[model samples]
Target: MGAPGTARRGPVGEAEYPPLSRRSGWSEGSFSEMKYYEQGTSAERWERARTFFDAKRYSMAADILGGLVEEVPDQVGPRLLLARAYYHSAQLKRAEDQLRVLVERDPAEHYARLMLGRTLQRQGRDAEAEPHLRLASALAGDFAAL
Candidate 1:
């Protein structure tokens, strides 16, 4: 016997049932999060992220790009955008982490080196940033800046 008020059918066998609640992971408050960021195809999400970035909503762009970067770690574009979003949002540690990965994956990537150096510099780690900055300058063939 179920709990008194939990039965689907009424006591008199008149087939009465309560209306079902939504069986989704999302609630009303999270609907926009799901709709704009989580529930789209890769292309749609990428476009959404770009839109957010263009709107200067860096954190929202980062949230979407973070997932895209994770899904295709080998792809440089999403990771670069994710890192840029982090940098613009003043998420220095996260920007540094993503830039480091990008640099490690492609050491000759001048942009990633430049970004990593800048990220480190923003964190007040000049000593750690020097080598990267020099390398980025060398890679870009602007040795006068080095």
Candidate 2:
């Protein structure tokens, strides 16, 4: 066992455990085998995901956003983007789940509520979606929607 402040080294001197202060990207194997979206700093990965999303590569964007969402679970931006990516990719169930989480966290989140309602509607659950859509409209001050 190594000292409390030190990581145990592998036979060739590689760190067995990354230091808590470092933000190492997650990987299953060697660096070369890591996915492109998983190979950069969080900011870089975020930009990459955004670029993919803008290009209409929703599945690829979701692939990157999924990891980002896990890494920054408390960040509403990444979670929202992930949900959008899922929605664009026609992954209604996933989009609904993420949107539900956001709405649960902030009941006044108009965009999330709107997305959740749309997702449910896409899944042929119009009756279940009406309340959320109404609430979202109310939150957005669209009284006509009510």
State each model's C-alpha RMSD to the native.
7.2, 6.0
C-alpha local distance difference test of each model: 0.87, 0.87
**How do all models score by TM-score?**
0.76, 0.80
Name the runs in model 1 displaced over 4 angstroms: 1-35
lDDT of 1 by residue, 41-103 (tens): 788988999999999999999999998898889999899999999999999999999999999
**lDDT at residue 129 of model 2 (Cα atoms):** 99
Leading candidate by TM-score: 2
Per residue, candidate 2 scores C-alpha lDDT tens digits across 1-146 of 45444566777776487532224533333456757676688899999999999999999999999989999998999999999999999998999999999998999999999999999999999999999999999999999989
Error of 1 at 113 (Å): 0.5
lDDT of 2: 0.87
Instruction: Give the 10-residue window scoring lowest on summed lDDT in candidate 2.
Output: 19-28
* lDDT, model 1, position 59: 96
TM-score of 2: 0.80
